[model samples]
Target: MTLTAFLKDRLVYIMTFLFLAGFAILLFVLENYRYPGLIESGTMVYIAVFAVFLLIIWLAADYVRQRHFYRQLQEATERAGERDGAAIVNNGVTHEQKLVVALLQEQNAAFLNELNQYKRQQELRNHFVLQWVHYMKTPVSVIDMQMQEVLRELPLGEEAQREAAQSIQEEAERMTRGLEQMLHTARLDKFALDLHIRRRPLHEILRSAVNSHKRLCIKHSIFPRIDGEAWVESDEKWITFVLNQLIGNSIKYSKTKPGSKNLQFRIKEQNGGAVTLEVEDEGIGILPHDLPRIFDPFFTGENGRSSGESTGMGLYLAKEVCSRLGHSLTAESVPGKGAVFTLTFKPGGIHVME
Candidate 1:
């Protein structure tokens, strides 16, 4: 049934009933009167007119009261809609309505206060963490230089010497990665990760990163290959860092027989000026469950496969860098086969890295 039709019908029935009741009462009073001189014809007419006028005045007052109540309800609804969980109480209200508004106001104030407090605490914590990481770098560098000197002076069988050098290198690299992770995590939310961005050839950055890992690649027998001729517009330093991390992880995880080359870096161009770089490995593949969480901070999944000494932040940092550079990074893996890390970079638009 239509709302208008229902309201019209109900109003008509109610008004008719009210009028009939008023007329019936008037007739009853007139009939009960036995005074021939008490109520003269002129007095009766005056009383009848006064009674009808009084009934009309009462009905008008009742209608106005009901309309005012409905208007107040509508205004309150609109005011509530404009707010964000905040509430206000006007000058006049019943006890229950006042109590509800007061409770909501208290909750809103408490929530705001708590949020402010949390932000302050987090800022202080990040400041301290960043300072600590910076201070520790000097000592870490000193230890690495000292360790290199010690290995240089030691005499041993070829096998023993190689093993010892590898151990020292792994430890030093692990320390460096940890420092980067600590610094990155502390500053992740505060500022953009890109410190320097410019127009640079992808091959130049890739070459530099690979050259830096020459010794490790040679020692592990992981042959790294690069393909594609596309140049990207982004922060060279950060992009290079991301490439190094992915390439390094692939080299570290590959299970090729000792002294066998098993790493590949392939870049391809797609439609719409998009570039794709895939770093594939012949090492231990990530499990299906662990693949999704690989890019998450502090996620070292299913053995320390990502690194010989995984700090669990290389992939996370790389993901963040790619996002800040308007790119996307994804992984595909088959357990016991290998893993492939694909980086999709497009011109113009920052990647939303989490």
Candidate 2:
């Protein structure tokens, strides 16, 4: 829920009182006698008739007002459920609900704008952090190699020195990876990627990302398999990011069979000219409860596996980038067996821009 949303829910109680007061005043006006001249019986009959007529009008007006307010509340709730950063306007804002909505909407817009600005500022900090991480890598690598040589020359009594040096090297590598992950995650939040869109072979991009991570694949023994080439217009860099995340996730989660790694990358073209990129891994698949939030930014799973040193922004950023570039990302997992991420270049009814 948003700040304005919480405020609006509380405001509903205040609106109830206003409506009730309006009804009370209307009843009072209807009951008041206009003149004091006619016979007593005639005056009594006139008052009864007027009360009955006014009661119907009061009930009808209250019903309409309540219904309209309810609809607006529904719209606000729906808007809060979306994942994007776009402004949400409740459809229930009407003449009757204007003043209340104006207050809530203004509060919402102010908060969202500030939130966006903060994200942009954070992006700059993340960019610097990424550069620092890259710069430090060279020194870290050199130290690690030098330490290995030192360890090889050390005697049995120098075990402590060797262990400490190895630990330092490992820690340095860990910190570097963590910083890189954080930078990527921050980029996801900041929405700060330049998308150079062009028509490209989907298979080409998939293969390139797979080959780049070939070392990891070899270490993990994840096999690569391609089916067909489906042409689609999209940003290559962003698309590469998507592939890295999807395939990386597969490799990370793959369970090693007794003698082989159970991870594979397969791409297939459907009959309707749609390409499906599947990264299937026989590992700890996602739970049913976690599926709904898999694409949410910073959301991992029920376990703490997604957090720790790793920033849980890979899938989140992938979803965002895919949406902006006009593609659909879908996932299906059989718990404990495997998980598959399917990319649909053309979603159900959305036509691509040629």
Once fitted onto the true fold, the runs of candidate 2 whose alpha carbons sit more than 4 angstroms away are: 1-181, 186-193, 255-258, 303-310, 347-354
TM-score (all chains, Cα) for each model: 0.69, 0.54
Candidate 1 — worst ten consecutive residues by lDDT sum? Answer: 83-92
**Residue 13 CA error for candidate 2 (Å)?**
26
Tens-place lDDT per residue, model 2, 1-354, is 343554465566546655665675556555553433423546556765665567556655655655656655666676765533123444444575666667677777888789899978876787787688778778877876887788788888887897787677666645554554555555654443444567788888888977866655665666767766777767777788788788767766662433355556666767876667777777667889988788987787853264243346778888877886678899999887778888877643133533
For model 1, the superposed segments whose C-alpha errors exceed 4 Å read 1-99, 151-166, 193-195, 255-259, 296-299, 303-313, 351-354
List model 1 lDDT by residue over 65-85, tens digit each: 444434444466667655442
For each of the candidates, give the backbone clash count: 3, 0
- In model 2, what is the error at residue 311, expressed in angstroms? 3.2
Q: Candidate 2 — worst ten consecutive residues by lDDT sum?
A: 83-92
Report the alpha-carbon TM-score of model 1 versus the true structure. 0.69
Number of the top candidate by lDDT? 1
